[model samples]
Target: MRATIIHGAGDVRIETVPDPVILEPTDAIVRIVRACICGSDLHPFHNKPAGSDPRAIGHEFIGVVEDTGSAVRTVSRGDFVIAPFVWSDGTCEFCREGLFTSCLHGGDWGDENVGGGQGEATRVPQADGTLIPVPGITEDSELLPSLLTLSDVYGTGYHAAITAGVRPGETVVVIGDGAVGLLAVLSAKQLGAEKIILMGRHEARTNLGREFGATDVVSARGEEGIAQVRELSGGHGAHRVLEAVGFLPAYEQALGVVRPGGAISRVGVPQYVEAPAGRVLFRPNVTLTGGVAPVRKYIDTLLPLVLDGTVNPGRVFDMTVSIEDVPSGYVAMDERRALKVLVKP
Candidate 1:
């Protein structure tokens, strides 16, 4: 089998690797039908120190179950499924509470022993808990792209909106226009936010944001952007700010545009450590929420919508690449030439 490996920053390659097998009774082997590059994958692509050992990469995918371990009864071989970025046991306390990302026995893909999603196949741990079997939909359905988003981006955007407590008629300011950010705009719309302000510089992507429900697009940064959002929201700032770019500047913008009692939900996979937590959050009584989305928890809730055509979050994928060209996929996204890259193995 061939898989993607990250040797270092700006370095990704496809090479022949050993095929994965079911190691645990709860595991399943999924043959990749659709996979894609995630914005979070860029964190290591940009900052990973040189001279580090190479490792398998990629985490978002929808595939067909090729095999399963003895304990896997929820799904059988040949079942179409969506694998969340992380695998967790459904029996854990955290999983029962809808936080599968923190399950006691959960783990991520693309590790030394685990196969990456951008490959011919992958070994999925805790199959019953991590893989969401798609019913009434074939692998060749037109909804594959939309179903694929349930793996990470869509569920993640939904997480930010839910965590921020977006309500009907409330105003929302979404920072960043990446796939996650654009989908955050979609999430806000689905939650009934009357006003949606999307902050991004790219006109093409921001245009899609408009189609997703953004009533306004602020391309400015720093103070200018803050002022634009404030003016748009009638001077009190937005009721909710969703920060989808995992950078200091985006977070600062979130802090600047949120109303005094509003919330800032960050789901961009924070790239900074020490953030302004004193005067900004103290006197304002702003609530800071959002983290790695427990996508598994939201898949069931979002799948029906995708199937019913109420949303089209897959619009975020603007480019497609073969497994051998995944390196270029990374470059396209890193240089902002593509919003997201869909991989076909």
Candidate 2:
């Protein structure tokens, strides 16, 4: 089987690797049909040590079930499914509370010795709990992108809006124009937000953001960006602000653009950074929350929206490539030539 592996910083290759097999009664083996390069993958690509082992990379994927273990009942062989980026035991306390990402038994696919998304096939633990079956669209070609989004980006975007409590006629500001950020704009609109403000400089993405439902686009960067958001909201700031880029600046921007009593939903995969506790805890009644998206929880809710054509998350894919060309895919995204890269195995 062929998979994408990173041998070191800036080194990405497609090579043959051992196929995965079911390892637990709740596990399922999937033959990946499509996958995408996530922004998080770029962190290790640029910062990993020079001598790190060539490891599989990728976390978002949609595929067909090749095999399932005895405990798997929600999915079966030949069923098309989407694997949430985070794997969880559905019976865990956190999972029961709909916090699958924080499930006591939750685990990431490609971390340390675990294999990742850049693969021909992979084993998914807790299959019944993590894989969301795509009903009645077993042969739909366009379903791939929608299915793949369930793994991360779209789910995270939905998480951002929901966590912030976006409501009809309320104003929402999305910081960042990355795939997840753009999807956050979409999520806000779908949830009935009357005004969606997107802060970004890229014309391609900001344009897509408008098509998705951004009522306004602020191309300014830095403090100028924050000012533009405030101006749009008549100095009150937005009722809900989504921080989709996981960094200090973006986080700060989200905090700066929300109303005194509004909420900031951060779905960005945080790196080594800290937020000012004094500012967040004392300034206004701001509610700060968000983490890795509970993708499994949103999968069922989003699937129907995709199937009905009410939402088209696939628009986020600005470039498409074969899995063998994943290195270039990474380059395209990192260089800002692509919004999101879709890779087919």
Which candidate has the highest lDDT of all?
1
- The lDDT of model 2 is 0.87
Return the top candidate by TM-score: 1
Question: In candidate 2, what are the lDDT values of residues 162-280, reduced to their tens digit?
Answer: 99999999999999999999999999998999999999999989999999999999988678888888999989799999998888888878877889989988888777465676767
What lDDT does each candidate get? 0.93, 0.87
> TM-scores of the models, in the given order?
0.99, 0.96
Residue 272 displacement (Å), model 1? 1.1
Error of 1 at 124 (Å): 0.5
- In model 2, which residue pairs have backbone atoms overlapping below 3 Å? none
